[model samples]
Target: MPAASPQPRRPRAGSRRDEAARLAVLHAADDLLVEHGFGALTVEAIARRAGVAKQTIYRWWPSKVEILLDTLIEDSDKRLPVPTERPTAESIRGYLGDFARFLTDDPAGKVLLALIAEAQHDPHTAKSFHTRYLGPRRDQERDMLARAIDAGEVSPRLGLDATIDALVGPIVYCALTGSSIPRDLADTLAEGLLRPRSN
Candidate 1:
């Protein structure tokens, strides 16, 4: 009798994909974005580059934008962490400077701006971007500001939402306009927003 044909390997149980596969997908997405721009990126292409099944990509991400968003978040977390050990004002200032530099200097930053532009026209994209990325980041920043307020570092009268807008709005605006992002912009914003607690 002929030997039994080789059996195809089965996928791992449950929803947890292999870590290597996950990183491959994220890196593939970023590579494709750099090579072809967002308009040309697709799950098929990402799967091809990542050497994973297209279904695997779909199983992990609903869209290329989602993959890109995940990649951006991962890169940012590693490269642009907000300092937690310093004085509140110094921390905020350092974070703002880091954020501005990230936006202006990183490849992922260009993709982020593209996503933001796409979000303006695509409500689903907007919702996903906000729910998955922007919303969480905003919450983190807000908590930081709330702590500063409690400690009397930032003014109590400053609304967290407004404070957030004030802090990040300029960087986003300059990025959108293709204007020069002054290095001192972060310092100016931090100085304007952070104040000592008064008795």
Candidate 2:
């Protein structure tokens, strides 16, 4: 579990000081989520943990979920390296390979599981997760599938929604089951998607 670094009380606007404070808040939130779980986390607690004001958190984010969403996005930038320069199949394979890595011992992996649990019973969290995170990624991949269709790499009639699920479903299964994803699964999936299917 990562501890939040202490930050200055009033950082100058647009300064490295200011950015440090912002990162402190994010780090504090992640630490709290890890140490206490989301149920025990609060804006007041986050402020105390970050050494900032509650208003400081509110000035930028509307809710704790938004804070977690930002932290998750940051984690994705560091972990998920999709090689878009490659063909769609390769990019998607790269993505799944990275996705599998995150599900394994990462702090963000706990966040993913917590968010999944929250989404099941909480409609608002589900909507926020979809709108702020999941939906955009799904749409991006859907666009990739559309391009693959145009290039005749995928069947023109393939339903992108199902195709996206087919590609992602295994990763989700790993996330849920806490199983280690095989290294070759990405290549297997890419081959299954791009290969000519025999009836």
User: Residue 7 CA error for candidate 1 (Å)?
Assistant: 19
What's the lDDT for residue 23 in model 1?
96
Which is the leading candidate under TM-score?
Answer: 1
**Please, what are the lDDT tens digits per residue for candidate 1 over residues 1-199?**
9999999988676477889999999888888887887888889999999999998888888888889899988987788765555337778888899889888888778778878988999999899899988888887787787787777676734688988898899999999899989989999888877766666
Clashes of 2: 0
How many clashes in each candidate?
0, 0
Candidate 2 lDDT by residue in tens digits, 1-199: 8989988689756334367778888888888888998898899998898998887788888988888888887876676633445245556667777777776667786677678778899899999999987887777667777776666555623477887687778877877776877778777876776553334
Residue 27, candidate 1: alpha-carbon lDDT: 89
Models 1 onward score TM values of 0.84, 0.76
Q: Each model's C-alpha lDDT?
A: 0.83, 0.75
